[model samples]
Target: MDKTPSSPTAVEVLTNLVADDLKAVNLAIVERMQSPVALIPQLAGHLIAAGGKRLRPMLTLASAQLLNYQGDKHIGLAACVEFIHTATLLHDDVVDESDLRRGQDSANAIWGNKPSVLVGDFLFSRSFELMVQADSLKVMEILSHASSVIAQGEVLQLITANDADTTQEAYLEVIQAKTAQLFAAACHVGGLVAGSTPEEEEALQAYGNNLGIAFQLIDDALDYSAKQAELGKAVGDDFRDGKMTLPVILAVARGDDEEKAFWKRTQEDQEFRDGDLEHALSLLNKHNTLDDTVSRARDYGNQAISVLDIFPDSPAKEALKGIVTFCIERAY
Candidate 1:
């Protein structure tokens, strides 16, 4: 149940490696973002130019290096992953009706929803163009499948939203689809480009999948634990949006009749007020769901590191392990 800050060893290693590749990735993003489509160029630039952590591209680059890849295609492919991730963010903000992302106004919030949606579509098409240009059928298949999984996960969440009956297993499945699939694909594609042995490719894919799960679990934990200002959004955003995440699922699952009624009213009543938020938080605290969620996040972090045991001891492997630790320990 420990939620204390862990060392940032792994993420730092990955960060250093990816930092070196930023020049190429940034160039690719800048080049692709320029469009003759007028509004597309403007909106796409706004989102891409906003500057993100570039973690998706970093995963791709790190995976290639881990397998000793020497080809130049990794650069373009890495940028492609980032483009896809950014596009998802655009659509996600619209769906969530969210105003802020990464401490900045979301594209949908700044622009009208129609324009934001079209720009997101533009990014999706642009990403595919980049992947096709790389001419790796394997890479195309990986990203295409990841995109479908992400969409399916989003749909699944939409169906389950505000439904108190949502189970922990169902929630985890959605996360795997919505988030971890891309991470797995990025790392797996890196191995494929490097021509790594089948075993090595599988190991990297497993590592990425587990790492993604750990990263998301921690993110869910943070939504409950992080300060609203530091988290760059209102606290209990999930609850506010009628989304049942890990914490609420745990709390409601173990709750008594009264607590269950509270959650049910929030979901089915459609008349819930702000005080409901406080009531839900108190119930979750009373049931210690936050601690349970943190424990699960830690378990996933350990599982992510275990997948890296197949790789030989090297800077890449060490960084991969550190990323697992950093995902759970990151304060933001």
Candidate 2:
């Protein structure tokens, strides 16, 4: 924001810039998550209290400031964005039968799958409630459409999950919808509430969409590249889950017949063995898939930064740009 050579991390910078407003968003989240039914709030609070970067809400808040928005609506809307994200995560853990979230036991693991899923439902409903309370049909439309797209993305990912033949185009579609749409909506809603021009709003959406893509790409690659502590989960969690992320896809494409057979056995047939993860890493490095996947993330990160050219210089604008860097640099 200050054009300094040395700056704190992007989230750190944005956290400070929007500190007061983020506090309000947190308060709103706490208030809305409350329910007379004890388990509803308990399970919901578990995940909310679990450490997350809160990046999506930050995007909403940052985008609002980009347009010099003076209103407080973005705070509530930002919480709505987080609720939608948390709801999806809750449902996703149930679907994936995940054991851990944020390096801790998943809600589904602590509570039964049914409670987890039902609480996710509660959160989703609460998100709509917040959107409606904002009193903007356009905001509701955008978030509702994003919710649909995210659900569709989940379905698409499920269909493509174990199949190695899934194309890059199909995978991108999944990430764009599953991960990026909410990000786009979060940023777009900020601009919309601030009454930014359509062009400016679209730019904010583009920046957020690209940032989300980069974020997901890095996450997928990190499943292979990072350590348990650093990644906040097992290194081969995706591999163990038989999830067909980009690195595996690329490795499968470039691999020889034996490698292909291995991927088919492990990923498709789920016939995983002890050294499977090591073999998978070997193949990924041999094909440079990890580096290439990260390169792809960098491409998207660069696009995200480029679109910020539309916004005039401000601390929020610079912090938004820094977020792109933070996302891409995660691989390193």
Candidate 3:
């Protein structure tokens, strides 16, 4: 929050600011995930312990801090945000037939799909329980609607999967629903619990929505990035899964007939020969689609930062701005 040129990343700054609150959230998560059924806890713990950035929950907590919310309700709500995200990840691994998550064996890969999906459901139920405990119908409405929209987004992505002709508009719709909706709700509820003015809450929601879009855009670009491969994360997972992300969409749009045929055979048909991924990367580079995708992400990141202007300058505001920077700078 202190704008020192040599400060740690925004995420670190925010994490340190919210360290105590985050501890409470983590405790709540561990306590809530417990189940007498061994596998439920076991499988859920596996993913929870995998140590993601916890960014979504962090947004909820930070938004509460920004508004000077005095109550502890944000703690439980932040945990709820995480539960929803973790649930989606579990289901997504199963649906994507993913072997890895966060550079480790996916829950489904280790435990099988049925347990993974069921445990995801368990977490979803727990999330709603937490929401109910918050005792705010507005909060429940926002989060429950986000849950529904996320499911719909997954289905929409499934429909678009393996189809090379997927338009940018459809792709935006998918990310906005699946990713941004929760972000908007997370920030919105934070402001709501603080009794923020409608205008302030709207600003928070808009900020979060744009940040989520930029976050996902960078993630999509990273799937084909050399830096991602170097970081030991799986590159080309999207390509192997035949997922049509922005870079691929742009490449397909710009490609010649032979190139389109190549995409159809690989992405649409799911046929693979050696060097196919490399060739796909080549096409992306040739079209500069990767750079273009990053550019697009930056655009959204800027919008996120701009929306925060409604809030008075404070450490919270500065940290929120840093989050936007962190989201976009990941591409480099």
Candidate 4:
């Protein structure tokens, strides 16, 4: 019952920058989503209309500004980052067979899986087109590597699902690949665009890696704690999908014989019966696994902030710090 309020330091100052970039990103999404074919346009439009935080693009823009970037390529690069993320979400919803996203029907659920997938592919292609326009070999290299790593990470997550034997090490690898790598690349490229020194680029990369890890940890924690209405999806969506995240893995490892049996029955069994999800929640709460996960998230957030020390304090630096704080502090 500690309800401490978190401070703003990181991305808060970048509101205007994010706002401006978001307009460009949104416009780019609309233009890229367009198809002469009607079906693809309608389907892509649905997901595009559903509002998301647009954090990846914000990271790209903010990082570039912090390094004193004064060019237009950052705008295109930021848009490309958002497109990449949107493509991943479309594909993920199909894989998860998810019904809800951002309190709206998921693209896969609304448009059916096939069109959702094709639209995702279209977005992927559009993202590349934008990258090519950036005309920076280093930017192209960074995003290409990130896109490939994200796909590989998706496959790794698919492999781990329903496998109760998944270790913390294995789970961390999935997260680093699927989530953190793109975050790292997004910020790293911002530095790249600004022509930052090697050391500074590495520092931004480290900040993003840690920030991405922290972001994912907080997301997993919210799955258990946040209300369905607030989370825009059900509480046990991950468990229902047989997806094993950090909390479940940690809870399973720390749980006793009875708790372990409960997890196996709910998460590993071919068919989960009535009360399975409730029992799993009980085990997680009793063992304090959620709290432990949040603690780890805070630790990573601290590490992310530490990476900012290399940059002199400024509005951009403050915005970067606020982003870290908001990642941990948000209710949904």
lDDT of 3 by residue, 47-166 (tens): 999978889998999999999888899999999999999999999999999888887899999999999999999999999999999999999999999999999999999999999899
Write one digit per residue (lDDT tens) for candidate 2, span 154-267: 999999888878789889999999999999999999999999898998898898899899999999999997555565687888888888889999999998899999999998
Q: Candidate 4's error at 28, in angstroms? A: 2.6
Misplaced by over 4 Å in model 3 are: 1-6, 230-232
Model 4 C-alpha lDDT per residue in residues 1-332, reported as the tens digit of each score: 99887853444456665677668767877887788988887877777678776788889888998988878788888878887888999999999899998999898877799988988898899899999998988899999999999999999999999888899888889999989998998898888888889999999999999999998988877787756558687898888887889889988999888877877876778478888878778888887888888889889999999989989988788888888888887534
Q: Which parts of model 4 have CA positions greater than 4 angstroms off? A: 1-13
> What's the CA error at residue 59 for candidate 3, in Å?
0.4
Candidate 2 residue pairs in clash (backbone atoms < 3 Å): none
Q: What is the lDDT of candidate 1?
A: 0.83
Candidate 1 — which residues are off by over 4 angstroms?
A: 1-12
Off by over 4 Å in 2: 1-7
Question: What local lDDT score does residue 28 receive in model 2, on the 0 to 100 scale?
Answer: 95
For model 1, residues 187-281, the per-residue Cα lDDT tens digits are 98888888878888888888888888877877776776646567577777788788889989998889989888888888655558768877877
Kindly provide the TM-score of model 2 when superposed on the true structure, using C-alpha atoms. Answer: 0.97
Q: In candidate 4, where is summed lDDT lowest over 10 consecutive residues? A: 7-16
Superposition-based RMSD of candidate 4 using all C-alpha atoms, in angstroms: 3.5
Best by the lDDT measure: 3
TM-score of each candidate structure, all chains considered together = 0.94, 0.97, 0.97, 0.94
